[model samples]
Target: MPQTIPKKKVRKPQKVGKAQKGKEEKMQPMPVYEKEKIPFRLRDKVAIITGGDSGIGRAIAIAFAKEGADVVICYEKDDVDAKITASEIEKNGRKYLLIGGDVSRENHCQKIIDRTIKTFGKIDVLINNAAVQTPQDELKKISAQQLTRTFEVNIFSQFYMSKAVEKYLKKGSSIINTTSVTAYRGSGHLLDYSATKGAILAFTRSLSSYFSEKGIRVNAVSPGPIWTPLIPTTFDAEEVATFGSNVPMKRAGQPVEVAYAYVFLASDDAAYITGQVIHPNGGEIVNG
Candidate 1:
């Protein structure tokens, strides 16, 4: 519902700096969701979101901040975008940390949790949302390196982050992993990414079973084609142009739209829910 419809184009500004992303104020008109609709329901929580610098991660950061949670946003590069997300959190009158590093690395993974604890003292929520998708029409197109990196970032990071934060997480706490619709329905063009997403689903279910007794609930959010920065930069323009049009909604989803699910799962309202997936696809039947 963005006022100016989002085109699947790389929206680089005229002057692209270190991390000058064109989302917040620079979007042609803006993504449709209004901020006023959120009523600060998540007060007094500390949330850590990987890939929180932009897209669904940014939306989740802002939403948590609005609800009175201290937010920790982790990302690699995109300093401008990370800063913008932090600004929004601060503007909402909440404390936040902007972490820059690759989540796939074991040291970086542990560091994120360590820094979050050092800054916020405790972590109430962890959003494992960072991922990279490399589209390959043929299976052979995926090199060994790309395959390894894909698993490292898309799936392995979840294990690393979850293990790092498990000690601090209590019964009321929640961990939300970003799975993909491709997990349920295979992605012909994104073979490696699709496989990684499937692994994430398995990871989510297993972690939920393993930790539910300890009171740390685990869940996942599987999104279809959402208008995120990754799309423009990672995919071809034409593929991007028609990105979400195929969905039943006839348009792709916005990051904020999907962020709402994260907020819900992280909140006490979902205390009874665990090891489940909240699907925000544009009516794509992936057979839950």
Candidate 2:
């Protein structure tokens, strides 16, 4: 008797429609997630996070709330996102204030400090995290307007906010700047943006020294590729698809993963750490 050979079943490939592809391409990143147990590391503290309406800033804001801190979120437009963040904070049984404006403006930055002081009465932490980037393959392609806007939003706002809030920050206060991995490794396309980030790193170091005697710790968080609203919005479709593939981790990091660095810097856990930059950059080694 001969053994019967079974024929292999082959499945046909289904054609993907434009709608389906668009839906998949436009998928939003997970903005935040809470831990089962929060330690309340920032209990009773007041923190101001620029760009807190979305992306990494939103994660940091929610994390601060979970840690028992009241947060003041400074955002540039997008009232809906700001309100959503506020709702999240409130859900955590914490207070939140949403201030909408361009952080690039010095007056706006001052206004943020004034409003925070009025509402919270004191500012314990300042997370200078608002930023903007415009990619250009050639340096000559970068317009003066683009360069100025990048610098104003990315670095100048940090200066404006820091100066405005410095007097109110007491001993044990913290300032965490959001620099980028691009600052260290450099980004050919993001010339102005990377330059601003490098400036932020230097600013963080210098500011830490100035505030060291005052007991205020200044540090920077350099995040590699993180899955955030910024990725899809900033990059082309192809770039967005492969956003974090280059990282050693082989994937874009979640907002919560990078938020912990800010939380630690804001808490007593990182009291001895100052004038330093924490790399939440998916295993990329950035010297200095």
Candidate 3:
């Protein structure tokens, strides 16, 4: 009878999947999903959003559409993602125009504005939100070409876009630039990117003052670590996984959360707000 006793089997511990951990711990998904509940504040307005194919750009495009604004989306590539944004805009009963090209080129920026005017007659809002960032641990690792390219796409594009839309923008029209939290705090790995963002903040302030007499408002939105395509594209897997863990909120901000800031800046609600920056960086306090 004693010899007939069999050894008991033990169960091994199982590893948790990233996706499973995300769900089980109620972690925010890559792109936070949300629907607009605000009233139609931007009814009949015409807006242009660069990089509108995905990420924060897509969220802002959708938010603008829901607020009753006709949207002109300028994207470099990814027709699939652009189409998705277009469909969502159309679903909101708003007119959508998709322009595919590099916004960093001055000619392309002009063409974008020209097309928007041709389609919508006037530009009410211009969002210079297209940007790129390449992480390098050491300054020496950043080549001259890479640095130049970053500036072109990040800051130079904003200049070109602003100039292109300036003549078309009427009084009370808004210009919102997407800066970054790194502008204030700085990033060792993102030196060039942070520098450009700092320039954007200065541009926002100076542009706001320059346009004040003309009744046009210029502002910027500085987002901390928002879950967007940029994170996965720029950071490694480990970095991406722990992206917003260092922030005060201990979580990445959703595009939807940042989208509202753009909406408010574009609407009459921010009539007196210009040359200012909106911090949506998950409770990270910074001198703005």
Candidate 4:
């Protein structure tokens, strides 16, 4: 039989309501997840999580550490939050590295990998979780600066980090990217952010195919509205209060809830899974 060529999957754009993203900045109704008493499945593994100072990144950092991974936490600039997160990592009896800089810069990305290798001797897992969102009411409001900054921090960082760590990654090592439901369902307010997330989706799938030949796997998690600093940083008060209500679950998800998905994909349990997106968005389903 002749070998048949595989088909490339096409992505469809999703249209959503009109709302500005800054509406979520002032909200105080924080979402919570039940993560207590779970046994550490990632124990002793070495992983890197960008933006690990707070919210989803912080939750992932703690969860990964609990599962046995020494974590390298990279943040743009949050000294106090970073120190607190670092303190917790040490308290958990795990090694920790705090890297502060703009991940959008390739040189800084290289430095991150260098520091990780020097400190841990190897990189078993890489989680690209740092991102930014700017909700614009109108398409015209999405200035070139907004689009460029969004791509630089959100999509470009992934490229740099992946290239920087490619040589260090080996068989059984997995790469997890933090994509968003906005990529799947679209966000009226977060236009550029959604677009960059869509880029991440393509990047993850393509990278998975490239590396699967070597036993390295790549996957992603498309979280809906997990409470994070980004939410408070990007949206206003009332909007934050009603966050995640539109979903079938009728509420927002917590950072820890999303972290478990990362934990699963990073561990040996997901050895057979790659190039897939795990949705933990309070039951708001997307046809993936």
TM-score of 4: 0.86
Candidate 3, pairs of clashing residues? none
Ten-residue region with minimum lDDT total, candidate 4? 25-34
Query: What local lDDT score does residue 238 receive in model 3, on the 0 to 100 scale?
Result: 96
Local accuracy of candidate 4 as per-residue lDDT tens digits, 217-270: 999999998888777778889888898898898988898888889999998778
Cα RMSD (angstroms) for every candidate in the order listed: 18.1, 20.7, 21.7, 14.1
User: Which tens-of-lDDT digit does each residue in 1-288 have in candidate 1?
Assistant: 559866765765554344447555654445555334445668888999999999999999998887779999999986999999999999989998989999999899999999988988989999999999888888888999999999999989999999899899988899999999999989898999999999999999999999887888999999999999889988998988899999899999999889989989998777789999999999988786
TM-scores of the candidates in the order shown = 0.85, 0.86, 0.86, 0.86
Please give, for residues 44-158, the per-residue lDDT of candidate 2 as tens digits.
Answer: 9999999999999999999999999999999998799999999999999999998999999999999999999899899999999999888888989999999999999999999
lDDT of 2 at 253: 96
Candidate 4 regions with alpha-carbon error over 4 angstroms = 1-40
Compared with the true structure, all predictions reach lDDT values of 0.90, 0.92, 0.92, 0.89
Per-residue lDDT of 59 in model 1: 95
Identify the superior model by TM-score, candidate 1 or candidate 3: 3
| Segments of candidate 3 deviating more than 4 angstroms | 1-38
